[model samples]
Target: MAKAIGRGRGPTIIDVARVAGVSKMTVSRVINNEAGVRDGTRKAVLAAIRTLNYEPNIAARTLVTAGEARVGVVYSNPSAAFMSDFLIGVFEEAAAKGVRLTLVKGEDGLAPPEAELRRMAQGVDGVVLAPPLGELPAIRQVLSDAHLPTAVVAVGQPTGEGISVRIDDWQASHDMARHLLSLGHRRIGFIAGNPDQSSSALRLEGCRAAVDATPGAELIIAQGAFSYTSGLRAAEWLLDEACPPTAIFASNDDMAAAAVSVAHRRHLDVPRDLTVVGFDDTTVATTLWPPLTTIRQPVRQMAATALELLMGAIRNGAPAAGDHLLSHALVERQSTAPPNRARAPAPALS
Candidate 1:
């Protein structure tokens, strides 16, 4: 049995173990999110820790461990806004665990090739991959061959052989599309992310599902590269169609912001003349004149969770292969409204 601690004395791992009816090592494993511990045992330890308000002495533990855990995070997406938010979360968690995080961007503006990724995995204990990087079969094969622990974040579907952290992109996008349909916008234009990314197909599917269920709703899709510039061009093309949509849904906040710019160039009033909604409620979502209506993907939390998964995999000497699903939200702002009474004239599609 563990005795109650006096003031100024923090709850220790032994206290948690006693309360959880497990050994001290079990408590430690739970705190570090290490594998090998049974799920039921892990939960009991966690519950005990929560009850005791326990905080692990991570720095001291790192010293005892001798070697620092090295994690490589690979990304090649063009959304600076998304990356910034993600880094903040990853950095916070990495610092807490005394783990080192290295960012590697591909030279070709895509996920690093298998050879390049193999080089990155040489020294690192584990890797965190984002988007197309996570979706690459070659990257998965090379990392698997290298015997490195891995976590995939923000992917449509995790390769099913490693830790995957993501929100429900399909349901989130579907909800956003329903929001537009509820607002009386029947014709919606969609600007897609890079087709190579799994999110592109998943999000598009969600939007199509919503539109299909609504009467008198029509969807027009424009291919995009998931860049602000791509959003601008895609929005231009959409607005120039034979019958332009009254609402535009861009797959990301960066593209949505670009859509706002295009609307302004055409001298159209947002929400009143054209409504725009975006996925990923990143900083760009709020920075726009009319704050964008979007689906909040919990970018920071997802990254933080991915880092945790990676660290645990490193400590346990096993790749954690499981889907970690987080929550998402629908954020309504000034950028959306019911369709205007009089529709604007359309130009050429190209």
Candidate 2:
């Protein structure tokens, strides 16, 4: 029996062939969108692919017949969940296009050195930048000086920053704050993301806008590194304050989960004694005792789209100055709720 591809795993051509009840050659033709196959057979193959969520390794398929097309990716994110999603998107897209992807980890999310970047750009046609690497001027200068086409994901604004793709961090964070506000959370504590990433400022701006617009709501921010330890320290600081806020919002899931842990240590009931929310709906969001309410950034889809755009730029041999804005959603779970009156004070009148 052929083992089916599990969720988050790539489906093979043979697997598609079995589901479509067609030969492997027919499945290949369908994937290549080539003519000569009967309409009925083509439809069956496509339907099977859709049902299985199949993503073909296009690079492998085309390597024998066409010249190699390679794209390099530089990333430096501390969260394993975030990195996993981001790479999956890029690789899936690369496979679909039959383009080879080479990944290089940046030191602290910044490209290594000019010589290293020059070497990396030698055979690579283009590059994909992941924040905060994408936000670094030095990295951009290195790639730009090397004449390498590039795309960036999760950047704050378009800025014509080398074929950028991102969701509106400011809007998403604003909506998150609005959800908490609607739930009667007035004095909200925010843990800022790494200052090196542009998304951090944008998220802070969005949260601040929502808080400022609401009557009698107060916003207190703590510096964070977008890491679990940072979240723990920040949460501890907030909880230790004489007048700690009724609700806490961490910039990312790692920090948010850490904040939950801190609350547990303090003997606070989640969403009861203290409400907590996180940014990315990564794996950690649901692993907590009470699942986290968070903003879903669509990291995987964004990564995929960035690769697609980067491939185009590589083909054209010139960087494209364009912005591909993807969508974001606020995922509600058990982690957030109205303020606990006994544990915290009510909203102050302006």
Candidate 3:
């Protein structure tokens, strides 16, 4: 029988290392199921873990014993701010876990060629598909056929194809729209995300639902590719109308920043002449003048979680079933406020 600690705290990694008569690094390697320690040493660590009843942290609990596991991360997302944050999380977690990562970038909004995917499959134990790429069924099929465990990030919902880590896009957008409505903005223009991704539709649906539920509220929709340039066009389209919206809600920070630019170009004072809000509170959200009111999507955390899931699946010989929905928050910044009904439109930039 294992001896229990007198203190309330449970046995830790250090305790496991001590009981096994090995270094903490050894214990970590054993916990991660990495190749290195001799059979005897591995057995000793396992025995200590069992005897002490030590529960590894969530990241350490996934046992990938075949070898030093290699994970491939595939991304084709257009948002630089979002990708920068997400890659930081993934790299940090992978480094801590002592796993190798291979990055594959899709070209022209398409998944990596079949030959490239096959090569990637041979080199890596599992894969993490970042958004836009995650939405591609062909990519999923290729990975599936390769028998590689997979985890997808930023998908709107689980497709029963692999482990999914994302937030509830519909609910998040709905809440943002509700925030605008509460602030007394009834005519709101919504700039949508890339149509190729599942989140775009769900976000639009969320905004529409909120507008439909409220009396005297109207929603005007414009398409965007989740790019700053696309946002520019969308914002221009909405603002050029005979009856322009008092407020604009963009599906992401890039679009929201563009809306702010447009507002500035027309010499309209934000919140006094127009109120702009956005989702995915990325780096651009705060960097902009009059920082945007937006949804904090936890992009970095989601990427980390997805990688963890991919590791777990690689370890267990099967992907974990179901979706993991992380929480999102509406961060109120300087951009949103009650509409000023009496304001007049200023002259457009020459």
Model 2 error, position 269 (Å): 0.8
What tens digits encode model 2's per-residue C-alpha lDDT throughout 1-350? 33457676677665675566544444555666655667777787788888877787875356324645778888888887888899999988988988887778865455667677767765465789887778778778866654566788888865575789999999999999999999998899999999867789999999999999999999999999888989988988887777988999999999999989888877788989899999989989988879999999999999999988776544433335698888999999999878988876332222
Per-residue lDDT value at 135 in model 3 = 78
Best by TM-score, which number? 3
Q: Write the per-residue lDDT of candidate 1 for residues 251-325, one digit (tens) a residue.
A: 999899998988988888898999988989999988879999999999888999998977765454333678999
TM-score of 3: 0.80
| Ten-residue region with minimum lDDT total, candidate 2 | 312-321
For residue 35, what is the lDDT in candidate 3? 66
Order of candidate numbers by TM-score, starting with the best:
3, 1, 2
Pairs with backbone N, CA or C atoms under 3 Å apart (clashes), candidate 3 = none
| lDDT by residue (tens digit), candidate 3, 95-131 | 8777899999886457888788878865666788888
List the candidate numbers ranked by lDDT, top first: 3, 1, 2
- Candidate 1: which stretches are off by over 4 Å? 1-64, 107-109, 113-115, 345-350
Model 2 clashing residue pairs (backbone) = 58-95, 58-98, 59-98
Clashing pairs counted in every model: 0, 3, 0
